[model samples]
Target: MITDTIEKLVAKATQLVHLFNYCELCEQPIYQQVALCDHCVSLIPRFQLDSLSGDLLNRPEIYGLYSKCVFDHLIAISPYQYPMSDWLKQFKYLGRWQYQRLCCRVLNFHLNELLKLSDFCPPDIVMPVPIHINRWQHRGFNQTLPLARTVAKVFKVHCNADCLVRQNQTGSQAQASGQLRRKQLKNNFALLPNETSYETSNEVTGKRVKLEGMHVALVDDVVTTGATVSEISRLLKAANVAKVSVYCLALSL
Candidate 1:
């Protein structure tokens, strides 16, 4: 009985350690698994929840920017700014693995809240916008993969990285104007042949999975000019995907 009591105490102590962490922003001891403490989390800028909907194009700010969009919907946690941008750069360029875990947890929590309050339809499949093989080799990872997997877990859908692919390596669009970005992004993406076979929830073993009529959540780390995702969305549309929803960590206005 005494040994059992000791083991139970040790387990509870370990559980507490896992549950609490120092807030990334404020360094306060936060009593949750999320990296940011409540105070710091509140300080992160967010779109007014009241204005969000199934189609973000309904918002004047977003609509004015994307007057016409190929993708059916958009969901994002914050505008591209401050700590979010810093976190992404650190994880993508510098490869701070902790930031990857931080980002996944933060985005997962934000998406959970959004789903609870909105009538948004969960997607049939989750797909991370693919990077060129060359870049993948250089970077050793696709920065969006972890975020995409998190979304797939939340929606309980297949995360297919093999279907859509970045065909050409283009120069950075960071400094380019929207018009230039769009021009450069044209034909930048292509889909794998539909004949490709895979294991999927809707199909039997050894059968091919068709994207036709499936709703896809295209996950990305950020949306700057929206060129990359828009181009990818067009490709998915050509594949007969019934819907394509853009989900990203941040949006640059």
Candidate 2:
């Protein structure tokens, strides 16, 4: 590939910006399309499986299944090997939403990968998994929604942050066995009793529901246990979502 003068200048400028923003974990510079710090990048896992079914149906957390990955879309890319040890800071404490946008933007380059995963081209809706009202209230925002919105802007699909919501008071699925995890979430998800048409906002309040299905791409900030994705799949299935694909910025592996 020939590097033209303007293109070279733009690339150099990008590298400079990233050098200043070098990954906190590895202390090395980050560059365009780079998904992880060197150390974090080295931690990426390779879990051998007889099939994806174990991760999907029974022991998904081992694969960080979270029910949010498989059965959604043939997920193309992920940069999930991050280790943000500050339990409070990484998720809820230090306001990490700003840095999260880069993940979505990085994904813009992976649109071709996402498209190739499906026999069909692009999907109709880019849906971020919804956080509960209480969680949203406590955290003051939904992290994945912003990323999904940017992805929608790039991909030109309708970004529907309102369709699938995390119901209130659901216990965290941080570390649990598949059976225990499922039990913890018994009857936790519910579809709001209302309309999910194109004109609607695709949200669910205590008394309302929004989101219809043609083809949906489930978006999330991270996937650890397949349980979350599986749970999401069950709900979308009930809602008549035609094909559920997943597009996430990070994966536990």
Candidate 3:
């Protein structure tokens, strides 16, 4: 009995040690709640509002930068550069779930700041860019789902993973040019039949009308050439969603 008890205790201790958080970049101990150490967090490249400085309304370039191609707004935490690129590869291909926490912490901070800007309202619901069934099965996880869930929880909004579905296994867009990527992504997403309406109370005057006038935030791990967001946003617009905003961990420059 004593031997069994000791073994059980050792197992529990091993589990606890594994649960302790460490920075993926520096491999240094960090707060249990966050995946990144303070120094590593500071090292991650960030986007600045100044880079977006221009008359957004009159300047097509400025408008296109943030609000174009069917989405009303874009919120990206970092540029797809250096350490972020390496980190994302590990997170997605290697199944580093801890990286999700790191992503959420940074995203939450930026999202909150963006919400403070004029005319920016928190989205009614959050959705992840869906992966094809075959790819999902092979990977054993849809990487964007965790990001969507975390963002939804931070904003107190609902996350509906089933709202959109990828109909075919479109291969990687990594090498495709912008025009080619757009062509490849066409007609790839379809809304689930049962999730057409937003649920709400009478005080909120909720009505079943194919996402009628509802704002949606789409979450993704990265944005490259924006083919994914563009195609998905096109589908959401067709459904009459009032607005679509994209939130991504990184944006390819």
Candidate 4:
């Protein structure tokens, strides 16, 4: 009986260590495993697609003045405003890995609602926007990978990080203008070897995977000019992916 009691105490201690009880923003004790407390969550600006102009939804060719390319749909959890912007900076730049759970929960909730829409369909595969090996080594993680995996789990779909490979060590896109970002990212990604066979291989054969009828969702942390996702969507389309959708945690508006 004492051994069982000790084990129970140890398990509880572990749970407490992992549990997030305080709001990331205000540092107040919260009841749930969320990053932000209820007040902060409500204060953050959410992207309401329904309230936006129909042109933003139906047109697809242009989001404001920025021209979108091959991606057919765009879904963002929140606008790049206020606390969200701060949260993203902490999560990505400052390496607050715990923030991922909160971000994923928000994205997953929004994605579920999106899937209910008449024209929307769940993707066959979910992929994180790949980072170059050198970049990943520097960061110790691809920020989008966790978000993508969480989303894939929610949708019950495959999350294939290897399906898309970033070949170039292009520097940060954060400071670049839209045109420059596009120019830099062009031809930076390629399909993984033996992608179609669903097998992992190290050989970098020139043979491309045939995504003939598959719908793919590209996951990223943020969308600024739509340049990065657009370039990736172009490549996916070139490889015969039937549809490409871009999902981001926030959109810079």
Q: RMSD for each model, in Å, please?
A: 2.9, 8.5, 5.8, 6.0
User: Which 10 consecutive positions of candidate 3 have the poorest summed lDDT?
Assistant: 49-58
Candidate 4 wrongly placed segments (more than 4 Å):
1-43, 50-56, 59-64, 197-210
Worst lDDT 10-window in candidate 2: 46-55
lDDT, model 4, position 107: 71
TM-scores of all candidate predictions against the true structure: 0.86, 0.62, 0.78, 0.77
- Tens-digit per-residue lDDT, 1-253, candidate 4: 9999999999998887677488777898776676666676656678665443211434344354455456777777787876678777878888887777667767766666665666556777788998889888998899999889877877776678877888898887788998898899889888875664342233645444456778888999998888888888988888778998788888785
Which stretches of candidate 1 lie above 4 Å from their native place? 1-15, 26-33, 37-39, 194-198, 201-208
Error of 4 at 142 (Å): 0.3
Sort by lDDT, best first. Answer: 1, 3, 4, 2
- Pull out the clashing pairs in model 1: none
Comparing 2 with 3 on lDDT, the higher-scoring candidate is 3
Q: Cα lDDT of all candidates, in order? A: 0.81, 0.57, 0.76, 0.75
User: Which whole-number lDDT from 0 to 100 does residue 133 have in model 3?
Assistant: 94
Off by over 4 Å in 3: 1-31, 37-42, 49-68, 115-119, 198-210
- Best lDDT among the predictions, by candidate number: 1
**Candidate 1, residues 100-152: lDDT per residue as tens digits?**
87778778777776677666678888999999899999999999999999999
lDDT by residue (tens digit), candidate 2, 1-253: 3569889999999878866656545657666444445455334332221233212233444334443333644453443553322322364455765345335444554553344443344667777777778988888888777767866766676776655555657656666776786676655666555435445234532433235457777776666555566677678777787777665555554
Candidate 3 C-alpha lDDT tens digits along 21-118 = 77766888765767676666766787763344311222455356545466777777788887777778877888887666677767766666555666
lDDT of 3: 0.76
- Deviation of model 4 at 184, angstroms: 0.9
